[model samples]
Target: MARGEPVTVEPVVGEPAAVADLGGERALLVADVHAGIEVGLRYERGVELDSRADARRERLCDLIRETDADRLVVLGDLAHRIGAPDGDEREELAALIRAVTDRVPMTLVEGNHDAGVAEAFADELDVIGADGGVLDGTVAACHGHTWPAPALLDADVVCTGHEHPQVRLEDAVGGSRVERAWLRGDLDPAAFTEAGTEADLPDDPPELVVFPAFNERSGGTWVNVEGQSFLAPYLPAALPAADAYLLDGTRLGEYRRV
Candidate 1:
């Protein structure tokens, strides 16, 4: 693929989602869909709630249809928990993955929470490295928990998802709400060069796009607030002037930690 060729990245409307239209390599990118989170809520937080696995599966299927994507790239955390999946969790995850894969190809970039996932989904899908994977051989993606492999930094654009970025909005009545938001900015090429990979960066450096958690129940970082720590390793160095946008393509401008 030509490095100079422009690819279109847009947010999927009527939902908290995004997609990168790479011509024949079109893909829908979503992050941090912590399947079986309801299990955690019940067991850990002691909250009684119905399982949302069916709802999540339907939401994902609908988004896939809307985007008309040939492939689905999950940024990471395809399942909850740090260890192996239990019977209930495995069933929910398997069902969701089966539902999507039955329609189109799926790739799960390993996330911090994705341990034992490779074995779990071995027959259904190929679980890629935590370091990241290249989409359409152009855009590089990682789950944002660790330093990405040097190879992943050489793509036209870098995408990551571990942050689950969100912005805080307060109304006149002193009530505040946090909504999922997409974070977009350019990376500094000099940083890559300084790391002794000067030739790896393109003449025009790639932009960085951080995806919000796809699971609605997953709590997110208050990105626009003061003293909020960023979780991604490359984030502090990239110093992304993160512009927050809703899924409807409404631009909220640059959101900086206060």
Candidate 2:
């Protein structure tokens, strides 16, 4: 019911979502909404396509209802545009934010793509700074485009998105497929301490959970594929022994080996 309280997280069985207990508030955790990506594709790649904003909003609203979440905690990337929103992106965000907040209060831990987003939608939702948001004092959530704030290192668990992790699985006949995945591991203190972070390292570091992108359109790093690399600066080093799991709850052991 308050900060410094206990918290727990459980990934939804087959969806890129989690039901988190931030003390007394139940929250549905998702990341990388990337609204109006259609506009981005059309302009950048000349790949015209219809917008899926309606479906995206409905899917998110349904998740909130299904999970009975009191709040919607988006780890980051609520907007697709790299800078200030305009045109279709603004329209899309307005509708999405209104729909979600109408169902449940929302928190936006601003992601890299969310430049000027908070200033644009300041009144519609709660905006946490780029350093990340601390919930229940025991859990931290950040968009993993940068090092987590020094203060977040103290939580029992730190949840992040922006890696948008995916894995390439090969079958016996040389067939292959890519699937979104969840990555988790114990935090490695060296990544921060050695990097000259300001916070004192915890004696035993907390768990680090890298969530998959909620937007399937946002292609991700092929973690198990050769030549692919992680986007986060502290990844692999910070989570040297991270394990990967498919959205269906299939554990594939070590991510690099999977």
Candidate 3:
């Protein structure tokens, strides 16, 4: 509940989720919901997908109720499509939103995948733009896929859900496993210089926090690897060095980079 400390909750295996305790009021923070992920996979990539949307929603709702959080902060990628929400997806998303909003304040931080869909649910939710906005106690939430705005950098603590950071842990069989993780580190000031956005760099890099993607289909952009540009800025040795927190339900631990 204190600064730099997150009370962790472990969800079932294969269920991607996490919660952050913010003092008296807890924050049910989830990322990359990608509401219509199955539809996108099917229509765009020709992959037959099955998403347990109902079950997942119910589980998430149960968690929220259990935590007694004052609000739910969806980090980003609430919707999968860029333009419109399909029939089934729209209904499911609406139902899910309604179910949560009925109980507590639900805020959405727009992600790249959440363009027009926000307007569709504007009446039912408080949707923040890419620039994001501040909440209680220096807490700023945003979808971390894009460059952060100057204002966000000035917040006491910045939280985002882009990059879907994951760490590779090998099983006994030597097979690799990837679990959704949170990257907690200071903002890299050098990233701006590298991207030629030095003029935009903040006087000081704020404490950086990256939430894991809530959508199961969305893994992570492997940092520490070459030719993978999506998460280059968040990588260590970059301006604002970041650390990784691998989340498996209530169990949260430091992710050792290999």
Q: Which predicted model would earn the best lDDT?
A: 2
Estimate, for each residue in 130-180, the C-alpha lDDT of model 2 and write its tens digit.
778688778889898877788787788889999999999989999989999
**Model 1, span 152-242: residue lDDT tens:** 6567788889998888988999999888888888776555233554355556667788888988888888888887888886665674465
TM-score of each: 0.91, 0.95, 0.80
lDDT minimum window of 10 residues, candidate 3:
1-10
C-alpha lDDT (0 to 100) for residue 157 of candidate 3 = 66
- Two-way TM-score contest, 1 vs 2, winner: 2
Where in model 3 is the C-alpha error above 4 Å? 1-24, 171-173, 189-205, 224-226, 231-240, 249-256
TM-score leaderboard ranking: 2, 1, 3
Q: State, as a TM-score between 0 and 1, how close model 3 is to the true structure.
A: 0.80
lDDT of candidate 3 over 123-198, digit per residue (tens) = 8888888867766546777776566555665455677777787666667899987666666666665552335553
lDDT of 3 at 192: 25
- In angstroms, how far off is 63's CA in candidate 3? 1.6
